[model samples]
Target: MNEPEAVDDLIADLPEWATTEEIADTMRVKPQTVLKWNKEYGLKTVAVGTRVRRYRKKDFREFLLRSAEATD
Candidate 1:
């Protein structure tokens, strides 16, 4: 499946933060699932504004690696 537009934009722009949609697209999951993971697991996030949420590339990669290790 094609990556979501928001993810493509995020990659092209190479922002310091990624939106929930961007991360969800990378994982091939729904945004809601991403939010759940953020809440249940330690998917760390930082707020760019009062409501806008974003994930750091480094932290997200670390989370993915840790999660993979957990499954293995």
Candidate 2:
């Protein structure tokens, strides 16, 4: 399959709500990079309780798609 399709499949397999580590693992990046994306690239996050944050799979998918389109 093409790279985009493979990436979509990978994102589809992620849990509905994911942590920074999970996203970093799926994208083959360090967890720090995911946090940086949240701060720098408008990667959305949902606050869980008071001290935690989770990322929605759909948002991550959209972010990836947007990044891809921006580069092309």
Q: Using TM-score as the measure, which candidate wins?
A: 2
Candidate 1 lDDT by residue in tens digits, 8-38: 4444543568899988887789999988888
What lDDT does each candidate get? 0.74, 0.86
Task: For residues 1-72, write the lDDT of model 2, one tens digit per residue.
Answer: 226676689887789999988999998999999989899999999988976889999898878877766667
lDDT of 2 at 10: 84
Of candidate 1, the 10-residue stretch with the lowest lDDT total is 1-10
In angstroms, how far off is 51's CA in candidate 1?
2.8
Worst 10 residues of 2 by lDDT: 1-10
Question: What TM-score would you give candidate 1 relative to the actual structure?
Answer: 0.71
For model 1, state the Cα shift of residue 72 in Å.
Answer: 3.1
